[model samples]
Target: MNRRTIQGKYEIFLQKYNEGVKKYIPIYRVKKSIHTWYNAR
Candidate 1:
């Protein structure tokens, strides 16, 4: 039972972390692309 609960918590943490990364990745990519374009100009 204790191990199950710990595993559940770890799973939840990973889900949240993955969601956060997913949300930020697009923003990061957009910013990077814009920076590169402006620098090239």
Candidate 2:
């Protein structure tokens, strides 16, 4: 309803988004490594 509340929600959303990205990057790296290995073979 207010600017302060909206800002708070945005902060929370950013934190969750960053957390999700952190979780995703490792899996992405692993997949990339596997793909590279498969191609090499």
Candidate 3:
């Protein structure tokens, strides 16, 4: 039971970790596009 609880918490932490990565990835992608946009203009 203790191990299961730890696993559950770890899973939750991984979910948050993935969510953070997902959120940051799009922002970073947009930032990268800013340079190209100015060049194109």
For each candidate in turn, give its C-alpha RMSD to the true structure in angstroms: 6.3, 6.4, 6.8
lDDT of 2 by residue, 1-41 (tens): 26568789899889999999988777533443445546645
Model 3 misplaced stretches (Cα beyond 4 Å): 1-4, 26-41
What digit string (tens of lDDT, one per residue) describes model 1 on residues 1-41?
A: 36678889899889999999988877533443455546645
C-alpha local distance difference test of each model? 0.76, 0.75, 0.75
Estimated TM-score for each candidate: 0.50, 0.50, 0.50
- Off-target runs (Cα >4 Å) in candidate 1 are 1-4, 27-41
* Candidate 2 Cα errors over 4 Å, as ranges: 1-4, 27-41
User: Candidate 3's residue-wise lDDT over 1-41, tens digit each?
Assistant: 36668889899889999999988876533444456547645
Candidate 3 residue pairs in backbone clash: none
Cα error, candidate 3, residue 39 (Å):
29
Top of the candidates by lDDT: 1
Q: What residue pairs clash in candidate 1, if any at all?
A: none
Candidate scoring better on lDDT of 1 and 3: 1
Of the two candidates 2 and 3, the one with more favorable TM-score, higher being better, is 2
